[model samples]
Target: MSKKVMFLAHEGVGLGHIARTCKIANHLSEKNMCLVVTGSREAAWLLKRSVDFVKLPSLDGLITERARYLGTKLYFDRGDEKAIRFRKTLAEETARHFAPDIIFIDHTFTGKGGEYKDLLLRSGSEIFIVLRPVLGTREESVRHIFGNLGADLIPVLQPKVLVAGDARTSTSSDDVRSFFPTIPIEHVGYLAGPGERTNPSARPYNILCSSGSGFDGEVLSYAMCELAEKQPDISITLIVGPRGSNPPAAPPNVEVILETHSIHQQLERAQLVVCHGGYNSVIEAMSHHLPIVVFLGDGVDPIARDERRIHSRLLSSHYPLLVCEDVKELPQAIHSSRELPAADTYPNALVVNGLANIGNLVATASPAKASDFVVTPIDRTGDG
Candidate 1:
């Protein structure tokens, strides 16, 4: 039996939220009918064929700081009620027709401006919120999960939360519990899917550089260009995401992929990875046990900046990676990171079975048990 599951992923400064939802949707689509209603500008091409997609009016242009970061003009501010009403109506209308068995709201609960709050509360479907820590306040999360309606709607709606990180590294699950003790919260690992791995001996001694979504990838773009100029003998591939401005001119040795559906293919050949500390990028690199050098950018968005800072700090402690804050130090970081040996197997510091864990959550809603699809990952050290 195929159950209808809908995911609502509102766009932020980057594509992290939508990319996270898409990974889960792709995993569950084999057993369920998945429809993703997202506000991400790149949803049309970013999603896989297994999942269906619908795009909402983007709020990217309305965000002044984001607009400034992207070098675009802003027409309005957050108080535009007309924009809110339009998005709310569009999303609600889609939900009324789709009639999903489960609705997963990613990151922001209120949509851009109270768009999904009322829709989520009034809808009879099972509600699940996909949250990442250090993004929003607990008070706001409480308000979004359980509005002023008290415990009356708890039984009828039965809203739950799915934290998109591991409990061992992140305090998100504990943080959410302090606010809503009764709300069912599960740490579904890193919300990243498994990727292909290549043999260490067969791979080239090259570097793969990426800034997720390219929204704030300018710093990385500049640094890579300089690195390429300085290191002419080395080969570099830079993936510039579609949503932002074009990066600086690259040398012949640097290959720039503007957009692509298959990053796993690129991951297959690279010996090292240099990236911004986005969740998707880091987790994907870690799954391959590739030596990563994180170039932490100081951006205009405080929440996004803090997210990168915290995630990089947490990963650097356990994994074999270096977190470099300055672009000047990026070359040295890269040189040092390349010498770091690849782990014989996946690191046990974090859970990489996020796709399997999410499948279990969807199976709970249907007649089938997700255990049929879940595979428990083994924990091991580099020596073993």
Candidate 2:
């Protein structure tokens, strides 16, 4: 029997979460029918053809930036009221029409006191699963509150499984297990994999750096210029995602491509990757067995700290990933990463097994069986 699955991805933030969800949905779609509901028009457009999508209200601009800044400090203000109502209505409508066998929520905790929480709780018999990144700590008290809300709401919402998409070494999973021990933790390895192409342009020594919409281009350009001055022989390709508002000019040896689909293609032949410590970029580079030079920009955002933490862990693991704090150090980092021998350290089998497990779990768990699940709140007070 074809199990009906709905994947809910929130928008107005970096494309990481949505991109990860899409990858999972694409894989799952092979065995079952999958639907993606997202608030990001850009992500929806990017994924519309590959997967079924339900577009919600667009929450673009600084609001998305603010959410990234605050981390778990998710608060519902007047602006959120309309979003809340819309999400609830949409959730209900989706449930009524799709009659999904299972519901998977990416990143967002739907069962907590939010509008979606009420809808999920009221949905009656559907198995609501929370698909999250490896767990981590947040600076906000509200995050704890919401964590508790999520923990409590899970039983009420009756999720048959909890899927944690991250490596075993991932701190995010540690945090999740610590908070919600009762919830079964299924570790799906890193969501990123070898993209569509294995061959990029034939360039002897080309570096690829990606700054998803939020990064300061001036800072990146300056750093790239410094690297170019030191390694004149190396060509660099800087990709500013489609939504990059202000891109800076690059040095002569460097090419700045705005919103190009050639990223994966480029990654195939690149000698090294210099990018923000986004999970997708790092994992994709690893998938291609390319060394990475991660720039953890400490801009006004909570994600900065998160990125720094993730990079720190990766560096500690001796994964040929160099973390650069200031632009002054970027040149050295790039040089160091390029010099390292190419090796594939990414765990490809782990990801495949996890996906298979999740598919089987979804297929076996009855949407009508609500009594087989347990939920608990994640304690926010603990020092993660």
Best by TM-score: 1
* Per-candidate TM-score against the hidden true structure: 0.84, 0.79
Instruction: Report lDDT (CA) for all predictions.
Output: 0.71, 0.60
Q: Which lDDT tens digits does candidate 1 get at residues 1-384? A: 677888989686677888888877878899988899987866666667888887887776665555676677766554456656657777877776677778887866656677675566655566777877444344554564445353345555566777777766675666666865677877777765555665556534678898888877888887897888888878788988775456657888788888777688788888788988787888778777787888877752555666677767776666777888888899999989866655543356676577788788778774322222221222223312
Q: For each candidate, how many residue pairs have backbone atoms clashing (under 3 Å)?
A: 0, 5
lDDT of 2 by residue, 1-384 (tens): 677777777553567667766767877788778888777665554553547888765444213445665343434444554545545566667755676667777665662225456545654445544444433344342253246356677545545444444454455545554555665556655555545333433555888877765445446655776677677788888777765543454567877776764367778768778877776676677667667777766552465456456645644354667777777778777767656643544333335244556666767766543442222232234222
Candidate 1: segments with Cα more than 4 A from true spot: 61-79, 133-158, 202-204, 344-349, 366-384
Q: Model 2 compared with the native: what TM-score?
A: 0.79
lDDT computed for candidate 1: 0.71
The per-residue C-alpha lDDT of model 2 at residue 183 equals: 56
Error at 278, model 1, angstroms: 0.4
Residue pairs with backbone overlap in model 1: none
